[model samples]
Target chain A: MPDSEAAVRKRIRGLLAQLYGGDSFVETVSDGISLRQAGVSSHALVALLVAMEDEFGFEWDDDVRPEALRSIESLAGHVLSLQE
Target chain B: MSGYANLARLDLAYREDRRIRVRDGVELYYETRGEGTPITLLNAFFLPSPSWRVFTEELAGSYRVVGYDLCNHGKSSHVGPEPTWEEHAADLIALLDGLEIESTHLIAASTSTILARDVALRHPDRVRGVVLAGPVFGPRGMRRQRQVQRAWLRTLESHGIAGLYEHMYPEVFSAEMNEAIGTPGFLGFREAFSALSTVDDLVNGLNRAMEDVGDPAVLAGVERPALVVVGDDDFLMGPTAARELAALFPHGRAEIMPKAGHVPFVDDAEGFQAIVRKFFEEVDARA
Candidate 1:
């Protein structure tokens, strides 16, 4: 079964925390804030994509599209889309 | 007097990881594994010490493999002032001294070779051997160098390393080698590299890389054994550049790694490690 949007967003924040080595900055950001505003670079996005692959059990080819990486909500939407 | 040639198997046991503050209050992140004569590895421009994991793990069985992130790069403090190759060389020396390693072999990738060349010449007694993988220290003329740098800087600014990778990988790696992107090893590398903070360092590192093309007259004086290895399909800097570099060293030799890219170590770790093992044994032979 697919995780609810809230659950998916929480997992992403969790992965971001791990990737940033517990920096916690991403977790502190407002839900509506985009990842780029959260200071996640394009390099970090690739890392996050790979981490999501492992955590969510799906493989994504090419890079994560810009729109999908814009905000936490967008990311959760992307994950849900992948599941569907 | 390390009987390097006699070792039939690498132990791959024991490991040490440390963060030491060297000269000028710069903190460096370093890790070591296996045992025997030490071999220090300097990573590529953008990636950090973790990029050396797979390659180092393979060699740790035979010798002590030390991998370190240059200051401002990895777990190391990015809180330092502007950097110079000379200062980077001194940092390497201080870090080695901190590790209690008097002299050891060196394996460097891409722009990291600048400091490797610096320290090797300034303190040759401290470097037992050197292997410069896909070195960019050649005299490629200012215009061409500037052109390449501008393109990369623009790409990095606009799209980041992911975009930069997409734009450059085709030029850097062969089609077959590029296919390794989805491998577990490469995935781990991508994760590690993403932890880094900003792109300013990449620009600085590349700028510093193009600033100094080592003088051939001085490189010829390097008495220690040196090897320049580039991938056969490395369009960026192929065998010609490698041969040119090798010709400058009194004891230097060059080889082209089959079916690889600008960074052959990442493309074919087995072939890269074999080349390094042989060169290391040769370096030990003279000792």
Candidate 2:
């Protein structure tokens, strides 16, 4: 991943933390951790995507999978792939 | 009876209570009125089924109107843990099966547009046409989604549900109408908002289901005629989004409600009803 995309990952983690209410769950948002399992509500997922759009200034195309929002790493990879 | 008492009695007389059991034994609150072709009314996320009473009555004058509370909203059975959009669509189809209705037209507002679109796309044989007001579209560049998320997050975090209502009022109604109509209804809204004050589960679940259905591809294959209506002043879903939504469907068109906001039905009921009535009439004629 490019340094810019990696930077986005870190920012998204922080944003998710704020969105999910800064619980202990935020500390464990590893790439493999499922966002749903990590207690990221659907609303948070939307907020995260919205936050990503604002931060990256790019919209997701129709071809993108909704499941990409499953994990932090998965979402980052998807966003980064879009950037590429 | 006094004049006020007579009016109340008349309203009570017109209301016909009905319910249908969907799949998984979820009981849904629904009402049917008027006659002729059927039209199903989908509930807005926050607004319960009864909130559509005025529009349902207006449309019922000429057509058969069916309005129902989705599972866990209003008086509907709350049986699910966390149902997905697909499951919600199943419930709707099951409702139709229970009612023994073959096919019907659909009208939805705000996030409920997702439900209507999903059902119509999956079961074209079961849906005649669709009318979406303040229609929510799939991810269109994520700007609008982000805007919605930010506004909602701010409310949930700082003010809770009460604060959320204040934040949502302007988005749902025009500034002038907010004072004229919304203010007068605040007391009743207070009771409703209070009930929703701690309803985090319902809110989050519904939001998640809506997100699942936000894929634009879902509507790409919808062949039914669609009318996308948006108020000129609706801050939540603007004209651009409405037009984009219309473009997604093969036979879709967009209409603007001048000087109205998110809930145009409340601000200008007659105007909104006229537009919808005309749209359905045209759809029928084309058929």
Per-residue CA lDDT of model 2 for B65-144, tens digit only, reads 88887777767777756567777788889988887888889999877887888888888889888998887663263347
- Cα RMSD to native, each candidate? 7.6, 17.4
Q: TM per model?
A: 0.74, 0.68
> Which one is best on TM-score?
1
**With candidate 2 superimposed using the best TM-score fit, by how many Å does residue A26's alpha carbon deviate from the native?**
53
Model 1 TM-score (2 dp): 0.74
lDDT of each prediction vs. the true structure? 0.72, 0.69
lDDT tens digits, residues B1-287, model 1?
11111111212221445788896568888988899999999876676776576655668898999888887665676764547778788888988999999999999987777677777889999999999887766634234444666687789889886666556656665665556445322333333343443677776766666677556567877778889989888765768777887888888999898777777876667778889999999899889
Provide the interface RMSD of candidate 1 in angstroms, 1 decimal place.
11.2
Task: State interface RMSD in Å for all models.
Answer: 11.2, 17.5
Looking at the true structure's interface, with contacts defined as alpha carbon pairs within 8 Å between chains A and B, what fraction does model 1 recover?
0.00
Cα misplacement distance, residue B230 of candidate 2 (Å): 0.3
